[model samples]
Target: MAKKAYIGVDGVARKVKKGYIGIGKNVYGPELLSTAGMPFMALANKYYATHYHVDQDGGFATLELDTLVSSPADIIGKWWPDGSFGSDSVETMITSRIRTAVSYSGLIIHTEAYEITEQTVGIARKIRKAYVGVGGVARPCWSGGELVYYGTATALSVARQHLAATSVGNYALFGGGETTNNSNVIDAYDASLTRTNPTTLSAARTQPAGTAAGDYALFAGGYGSNYSSGVDAYDVSLTRTNPTALSAARTQLAGTAAGDYALFAGGYNSRGFSAVVDAYDASLTRTNPTVLSTARCDLAATSVGNYALFGGGQISSSSSSAVVDAYDTGLTRTTPTGLSTTRYQLAATTVEDYALFAGGNASGGYSTVVDAYDASLTRTTPTALSEARYRPAATTVEGYALFAGGFSSGGYSTVVDAYDASLTRTTPTALGEARDQLAGTTVGNFALFAGGYTGSFSNRVDVYMVS
Candidate 1:
């Protein structure tokens, strides 16, 4: 009988000529097998004849023909016929079977020393976990635990906990009062809590005007045991054992600091209400006092860029005057512009280039009207306040001009009202204490009200922190 062979053609068993193989409809050419230098059909026949058994009917028996015709060790050294093999064929077969088994088993294939070129292993299944080289030298080795990882068996771990934290937007408040010592007291607050003690003033006083120059707060004339002409210097950021006094003693002075100098304007002195203006430099030396054409007290004063303005106040006649004066600081005092109505003891705050003058004592007692003036002393038509008052303190906080603690119609007021530059006033908020003649200063985000007279003279210091 001619040598018989069973071949798999498209997964179906078929009998073919011993020297030929069929693929699809056409039988393969002899050159196709000959050029490849292999009798594929003959090899298949030999494999089946030697390994498979014949059945009772003389036809080839169903054969368990899965046994290898060549050992893996043997296949390693040669091709099928001449005992020389194609490159990596055995390794390819083994790796293919391994990958298939691993996939079928649903397990991760751990590997070592696997080459990672653009081809071959690059395209291999799950090769990321595979090993390469015979000695397992190249491997995906991890030295540390899950919290750590390895690169070349070196452990690198991350911090399981966090690091230290820091803070921002923090600030300090300086030069105010507390609940004791009627005068000569200076305190500081931070973060809503008092951070410093009341640094004793050189002399006890209230309603003294203050201006900050660097770390120092220069306090000009205010009512002490008497109307004080004495100017005192307190280091706003430091504890004071001693304070330097002014060349002249006066009170109800309006002052503002600019650059290295603090300027004090019209105030009440022993000579009565005076228009004297004085400038104190960094060295605490006072310049010769320049006189204003109008002598007044309880006026509002502020520095706008290069010019200092002194607005409505009580004239020497004890009547409120509408005069507005501007001091060049570099030059002598000039004639002042008059207001629509006379006002005194008013609260003044600067908003950009304009100064807003709010509630003060007008002709009929306390007037609620508010006024605006440009740095050049041009006045705007007055807007009315929510409540008419005098001895009220004004400060600009967070773009709003706040008027706080003054004597109104009934009595002393703890009411706090805020006005925008547009002259619109908001509903007032009550303070912790009702007071008048209070010295108000702003430190950071908080406004400090210190040493004012309540129904009785008070040493109570209250702070308002604008959130």
Candidate 2:
């Protein structure tokens, strides 16, 4: 009898031919279930599998086929080979409930570093759990538990938490927030995603907004002993400059940068919800002009390409709002586009071309829904965060957009949900401490979440590597 070994695909021994073995449905190439390219093949009753082969280069190879289904309802409750939603995952290319189309969600599970990518997913019949890697690529060994949404554990943090953030070149910088009696500290994160204490801001304040122009980074308008009109500027060398004060004193505003100009718009001062906009140049000089159509506070602001978008904040009638305003580099304002959901105290960021508004207080209380928009301000399908929250900090690092620690219905939270271009959400790692009212920024692939109120006040800063 010819020597044979158990084929991993069907659990039946097959005679080894030279260095290769032939086993699988239809006896197709090892990469497929069928010659026509169906990755799925029938196994036990109601059980199907997609093949995974460990390449000689140590990478896992699998099929990403578009297979047709008679109706969307057919795959409604069906589980994918990797156990993630085959049809329902937001990043899934297949979302047809029913159509002339097909689905491709089950083809790719996740890239793993198990050093042991198997040839069969027929474990659908024998197992209910599996291992998944965390922290980007897995190392040489298993470093994960049972498959879960976000592989997270406690990580390190800076001494401060509620600090403001802005990026210059490949570094994310945190500056000026409340700790004990509002601090003027500055912590800079490098391209490798490490944090170092840089020069502190001249003025101490909390809730200041930041935007950068070329090599110059500006921090403006936060609460000191009281609402402030102060504007402080920093160069790439970490040197400081005192610019002309903002036209009006304010706090809790939205800010953005374009060209060499940075604009701070809409905030609550003693006047309560002012529409004032403060524009600063590379020289650290101020220009008070062009107000937001709606005056509100606690809004989120981010710049995409040549435009800055301000979205969702508190109004006089109520704190929760969905109003979004877009501005050109020339400071011309377009009519605000209402967000799909009305919420205030949300956080916003842009990853590549897509701008996102995530987590805030809505009519039903805290929200997890994230709204994505284009340059024209049109909204796309929204995704949800792992947890509903308010006052989360938002930024983009490498290719990932992240919303960090914030206040939820349960109180201050440390959950950090990272988003991809498709609004796919994942938890990287939680903050060292649970906090809210924090600020975040990205430099290249480095991210920093810093300074916020955690019961008392904290100066802790948490950094993450996005690449």
Candidate 3:
């Protein structure tokens, strides 16, 4: 007679003889087992195959078996031995093949691994509940295909549409064109300009100084068609024609808006570059026109709070001087501060509390060095521009000061460079046109260029929008 062997399921072990053991009260015998596939038979044989069996006398008997039974040591060494018939090591070896077969048959199995503790099931249930409301069906931990869930329908639709649309490149508003020797014909354009002339000068002239006043604009001291001493004004909000002229005739001057007045300083007159400092009120009235301690022209000027800075220019004998001077708008002309770097035909703009000056002709050649003066007119160490140029136009936008359109070492440049408040210099963007001695103004977010000479002279105006 055959000896009996022991088998275990769900932690319950029992001895069985030649007759099959009943699972769930259903007997699995030869007839019932024959209908079962080879896979089920293999699973049973792996876990329950026995080489040594118990005899009726309670002694162990050896049986000749096609497969060897694993020792208890070997069984204990296997991972997941009690949980499943195959060990993790064996499962790993057949994983690729099993995955391939299942994929080919379009079948998938969901398996989850977690700590076997009382709290685990509750955590899983909560996760399922949270995900299910969004069109996700919670499958049992043992069941798996691919996890599917629905997102916000409206948001998904919008995102999909946006992805399908065209991509756009980074763009900026740039100075376009300017007027000729005649300042009266001021015109500037960008994609937004669209054939409309936004602002015009009070008179036709070149090398005039311009600055923004309280809701008004002051254009002072430019050579007219006849090089006449002319100053003009326009109500910035109304866009009206020349409202009035300056009290004096001067050209090649520098001016900055300080407080309620646009202070005009040092420029060439019939008497040559004067050290004169003139202030124009919002009513277009000139007052307290005082002579600067040092006479200069083709220089740069900017206002920071109470002080107006005048920096670098040619003296009466065409000699360039590196003199920086500052005048207090609150006080009269007696007191002025001096800058460390004296540069001429440079571009300057106010960034926060600091006024920056960059690129101009110094000594006999163009310079790349940039300098700054604080509200107190104290100098900071100068930085270098990527290129050396003179007579460039500078304007401030979004904490950045832009310098563009000037006579550079590479010739007249359409290049635009921005000086960050941190005093870092960046590579420039080329303008649509190459010109020098242009005037740049920032209104709202737009930088408008008017009346620059392109070798000879041009009447085209360009606008760059900092978007």
Candidate 4:
């Protein structure tokens, strides 16, 4: 039940002539009880009422529930009472009501008064909420401020291998791979970690390279029944358009974006190893940039600052190469100090100021070397991975570079190694399944490793969330 009441100018409680009663979203008694009358329901179900009384009559009405109720834990953080407090007396009245709301009703509302500046005094402040994680605890400052409703073990719609991953706007996408046959499925995860199947690729091709620039996420070059030069571009809204294809149709190429350009460099074509470098600008304009110094296949690519770097790949079937190629925003090519180890199938990602290239097969044995390049392209060696593995999935989230699930001497690995911004290494929880050839990318606060071969093709998606 609710009563018609408001606070007087003298800070005294008084009954008012007009108001309504409401409970759990339903307005029960009296005149024209609309949505605004149902306070409990309007609070987005955050609190429940054993008994109720609230007032919304005229000058600074307050929440007057019989006994306040809330969850076991207090919703901590700065919050502003909805409307304007015109005078100091009104502010004091509102603070008193908040105290009453917390004291009688058990809701631990923190009514800390912020020092009002010229900017903050007259403006209305928004009520902020947070994302709740597992164990019903809220994780601070994330999108979709609601209870943790999404479930884990989120797998791709199809099982695949040799897939490619990239992110643009609010979504991270995994595209093109081989399953029973070549698959064109593009699985998407949005900011809320909800999965959606966007339009499939125009061509079903294995080992297509994925990257993003401006409003577009692009998948370019790979082998279908034949080598495909087709370039499929998806905008931030997941709307698909075919950009101009690559200069040469190829497979095992590397793709990355720097500044305003998305680039595809070095791959095996029908003509054997090709050194072609194709670039697409923000407007989807295609240009042939200076190619890689060495023609290679299965190279790794990552970007940091204003440059994109492609490093370490099989220069020939019998051996790997340490050749590291870089392209600045202007598409000018430079050969940086190569990786300390001549290796291919290495994985690369960015963390803070460095672009790290980690573990790959070098010689006959798997290599554990980890190399880092700063924004100025200065190279440094970081602490190596706990396990020597090749083809691990790599991505960054919350300043941490995560390398997950690859193959080593003992066979398939479930180990997940992480490196912070300072290059300090730590091992987090392992993947649910041991696999390799999976694709990895970030969306919001999550780093996801999806789809791989675990003896057989697997559709498992392992998510590491920074809460």
Model number with the top TM-score: 4
Worst 10 residues of 1 by lDDT: 158-167
Instruction: Please identify which of the two predictions, 2 or 3, would achieve the higher TM-score against the true structure.
Output: 2
Cα lDDT tens digits, model 2, 1-467, are 11122223224333211121123333222322222111233333222232332222222354533322323233334424444445543223232221212243222222211111233222212211123365773322211111122222122234454467787766677777765467777777666656676667777888788888767788888898888888777788777787888888888887887557788888898878988888776776677666887889888888776778888888975556778887777878785557888888898898655788888988888988888877666778556899999888888765568898899878889898887654567788788778898777766535666667788676565667621
TM-score of each: 0.57, 0.65, 0.57, 0.72
Candidate RMSDs in Å, in order, are 30.7, 16.8, 26.1, 12.8
Candidate 3 off by > 4 Å: 1-183, 188-195, 198-202, 225-227, 239-247, 334-339, 456-467
Residues 1-467, candidate 3: write the lDDT tens digits: 01223445234444432322122212132221111111121223223222222232332233312232343234334422465434434334224323443323222121221111121111111111111233474322211111111111111100000000000011111111223224354332322433333444445565666665666555566676544455545453335444344555667778787777778888777877777777777676667656776887878888775877777787856467677766675635543444445568888888655788788877768877777776666678546777788878787654557787889878878777765555666654566567776666554445554445666554344555433
- The alpha-carbon lDDT assigned to residue 127 of candidate 4 equals 24
Write model 1 residue lDDT over 1-467, tens digit each, in one string. 11234445335555422222222222122121111111211222111101222222223332322332444444334224444445444445334433443323222111121111111111111111122354854532211111110011110011100000001123232232222332454444444444454455566665567665545566566665776665545554454433345556777777775556667788777888777777776666667546777888878876655666778888856578888777675635665566667888887777555677777888788878777776676777545776778878766653456777788987888777765444556654566667776655555555555445675555454555433
Better model by lDDT, 1 or 4? 4
Which one is best on lDDT? 4
Mind sharing the TM-score for model 2?
0.65
Q: Clash number for model 1?
A: 27
Better of 2 and 4 by lDDT: 4
Query: CA shift at 262, candidate 4, in angstroms?
Result: 0.6
